[model samples]
Target chain A: AQRVTQPEKLLSVFKGAPVELKCNYSYSGSPELFWYVQYSRQRLQLLLRHISRESIKGFTADLNKGETSFHLKKPFAQEEDSAMYYCASFDNNDMRFGAGTRLTVKP
Target chain B: GAGVSQSPSNKVTEKGKDVELRCDPISGHTALYWYRQRLGQGLEFLIYFQGNSAPDKSGLPSDRFSAERTGESVSTLTIQRTQQEDSAVYLCASSFPPGPQQFFGPGTRLTVL
Candidate 1:
């Protein structure tokens, strides 16, 4: 069974501080990872995918094959960055999501 | 140009009743997916449909839950004898074939009393 794990339910950080949302996965084969975000009153949207290796909204995630992790990172957190972040893994035509982490960037 | 859309943004029903939720994928999208999100939990994959092929219903929680898609257009998820635990925001997403990215709908909020 494939699984995505996001250990933090809630994470708070002051503006301009670095932010890291932890995500780990369990899979036997090569995995396709993604970071999805949902802002206040906004529909869920794709932030980025490992295959793209591109950053959106100043956030980037690197798939660490050795650690089996794909943690999303940002150098400087912005107040608008506050939102719910979900880490997901795609395998065998199915996508599995983590419990999600609520990120709050205080100004 | 429109994104995925779901009907009956909100539905409230009594326990043991049946309810149907609808989703219309983006035009020309060949892959459609259904997911369930509890109040404070992540999205749980319920099912996926590709073109006119048979859908992957492996993620469905129980036998009481079933879904159907008309060709590659609208899809309906039906829940029989709904329970309180069945309450959640059911989301629908669609993607093009060979594309990993999925576009999501606003979701339907289902409540069972």
Candidate 2:
């Protein structure tokens, strides 16, 4: 089974506009969810994890078990926020990632 | 003090040739993992190593791909009889045991012709 799912391949939002990146997982157990970001020519780094429940760079994600979704949302997008975002789930000592969403926040 | 580092940042090999990629995890991190990402694709879990425990090799795609970690430190992923489809960026990440927060390397871009 595909452990993680990201429906959108690319998302574009204007500065100051709201943006949401959808992510869903198929792991049956309480797998840890994480959001990772990679800027151009940079190594992939952890943006935030569901376990922390803390917002980083104005981005927050809620784990909705009923829907099995952990959608990342930000009220106002910034150009610096533009990068590649990947949703990942860790289970059974393995981390599975989605196809990723290339977020472009235009000015 | 150094982050995860992968050697041979980029490699280009001919088809059917074997290639070895190396990774050096952070000190004191007993957990090491190898992953890869093809162009326009997501991260693909390749293998996981923790402490002295047996590695979880189930994620390996085939017998052609294998990895080894010595004394819970550096690791190397070897691919035998590489094919064009094997062209991708191989990434390495490491963290403390049972920690979900992994520090990733810059990744090695392998191009098989």
Candidate 3:
């Protein structure tokens, strides 16, 4: 069975500080990883995908097959970046999301 | 221009009753998915529809949960004899193909008492 693990339930950081949301997965074959963010009163939207290897909103994630981890990172956090972040992966033709990490960037 | 949309943003129902939640996927999207999120838990995959393939019910928790999609457009999830544990936010998402990136809906918050 494919499983995704996000250890942090909540993370707090000051503005301008670097942020990293940890994520790990267990799958038999190659997996596709994605990071989705949901702001207050907004729908969940895709932030980035490992396959694309492109940063969105200044966030990037690299898939490490050996460690089975794909962590999302940002050079500097912003107040507006505060939101619920979910790490997900494709499994059995469907996507599975993590428990989610609520990030709070204090000004 | 519209993203995925779900009807009845909020619903409150009594136990032992049934509820049907509807979802309208983005036009031209060939894949639709249904997920449930508990109060403070991760999203649970309930069902999925891709093109004309048979719906995948592998993630469904029990036989009480069933879902149907009409030709890759609109989808509806029905829960019979709802229980307190069934109370959660039901989210709908659509993607261009089978799976890659998905666009999510506002979700239907179902509360059972």
Candidate 4:
């Protein structure tokens, strides 16, 4: 079965500090990678997909086939950046999501 | 335009009872998906509906769970003999066909006591 792994369940960072949400997946025939986020009371929404190769809200993720990783990164964290982030893999009619990482950006 | 809508934002039921959750996808989205999220866990995809084709029910936990989509429009997921373990937020999402990105609904919180 295809799987996505997010090593950190919770991560805390101070404002102005850089943030990275680690995501790794077991590749099975070129799966698409995605990052989804859920704000405090908002619905989960698509942050970015690897295919797009574009940054959203100052966050970017690179799909590394060699590392099987698609880590979300932001140079400087902000309070609004605190949310639940999930990494997902979809391929071969199978979609697997990581357990998610709760990021807390302290001021 | 409405992104995606789910009925009965919350539902509480007793064990062994059945519950039906409804989802109304975006206007022209051809793909719809149902997922279950336990507290502090990732999405457990339950089913997928794409246009009028056969849905991918591979992620369904058991035969007691079944879903139907009304020709790329409204979808309903039914859970029979609900167990306490089934308590979770049932989320619905939709996207254009051949596109893997999804837009999610607010979710239906189901508590099976």
Candidate 5:
């Protein structure tokens, strides 16, 4: 079975601190990984995708096939960066989402 | 252009009642999707619609749940005999054909009493 796991329910960090939100997945075939963020009073939006190899809002995630992980990272955390983040994998016509991690950046 | 939109931002329904949730995908988007998010949980896929092709309803949890799309534009999810477990936020999303990126709507918060 395909599954996505986000071990942390909440992660808190101070401004200027580095942040990492862990995500892991189990799948048999090639996986398409994505990071989605939802800000307060805003709709859920795509943060980044592994295929594009692009960073959004100073956040980047690298898919590590060895450990089956796609952890999102930011060198410097900001208050504006605080939001609920979800990791997802697209399998054929189905998409599996992790439980999600809520990040809080305090000043 | 406007993003995907879902109707009834909030709905309070009695248990055993029927309710309908609507979604309007972005214009020209060929793929539409429905998902459920219970409090403190991640989004759960419920169904998918692509163009005029038959919809993939495999994610639907039970026969009480059904959805239909018209001409690749508007879609509606109907739930019969709502249960307390049915209380959740129903989200709608759309993406361009063959595109991996999906845009989500604000979602409808359904409360079953």
Candidate 6:
């Protein structure tokens, strides 16, 4: 069975501190991984995709096929970056999402 | 120029009653999807409409749930004899065919008493 796992339900970090939100997946085929974020009172939006290999809002995610991980990382956490983040994978006709991780950046 | 839209932003219904939720996909988008998110839970894929055909219905929880899309535009998801388990936020999304990025609409929060 294809599955996406987000091990942390809530991650708290101090402002200016580095943060990482871990995501791992189990799939038999080549995986297309994406990171989605939902800010308070805002609709969910795409953050980035592994294929693009681009960073948004100073955040980046590296997809490591060897470890089956696509962990999102930010060199320095910002207060405005606090939000709910989800990792997702698309396999053929089905799209699987991991339970989101709530990141709280404290000032 | 509007994005995907969903009707009845909030719906409160008594258990055993039927309800219908509507979704209007972005114009010219050939792929539409519906998902259910219970409180604090990950999104659960309900159904998908690619053009006028649904190639996958395996994610729908049960027969109590049904959906239809006409002219590859508006779609409706109806639940018969709604149950407490049916209470969730129903999210609608649309994108171009074979596109990996999907735009989401403000979800409909359904409450079943």
Highest DockQ against the true fold, candidate: 3
DockQ ranking, best first:
3, 2, 4, 5, 6, 1
Q: After superposition, how far is residue A25 of candidate 5 from its true place, in Å?
A: 0.4
lDDT comparing candidate 6 with the true structure = 0.92
* Candidate 3 Cα outliers beyond 4 Å, as residue runs: none
Calculate DockQ per candidate and list them: 0.72, 0.80, 0.88, 0.78, 0.75, 0.73
How much lDDT does each candidate structure score? 0.94, 0.93, 0.93, 0.93, 0.94, 0.92
Candidate 4, chain A: TM-score?
Answer: 0.97
TM-score of each: 0.98, 0.97, 0.97, 0.96, 0.98, 0.97
Q: Is candidate 3 or candidate 5 better by DockQ?
A: 3
Native-referenced DockQ of model 5: 0.75
Worst 10 residues of 4 chain B by lDDT: B95-104
Q: Write the per-residue lDDT of candidate 3 for residues B35-97, one digit (tens) a residue.
A: 999988999999889989998888899999999998978999999999999999999999987
> Tens digit of lDDT per residue, candidate 6, span B3-113?
999999999999999999999999999988999999989989898889756446778899999999997789899999999999999999888874558899999999999
DockQ of 4: 0.78
In candidate 4, stretches whose alpha carbon ends up further than 4 angstroms from where it belongs are none
Candidate 5 lDDT over residue span A1-107, tens digit each: 78999999999999999999999999999889999999999999999999999988899999999999999999999999989999999978778899899999999
All-Cα superposition RMSD per candidate: 1.0, 1.0, 1.0, 1.1, 0.9, 1.0
The reply for model 6, stretches above 4 Å from the true place, is: none
Clash pairs detected, candidate 2: none
Judged by DockQ cut-offs, the docking class of candidate 2 is high
Worst 10 residues of 4 chain A by lDDT: A88-97
**Candidate 1 displacement at residue B24 in angstroms:** 0.7
**Comparing 2 and 6 by lDDT, which wins?**
2
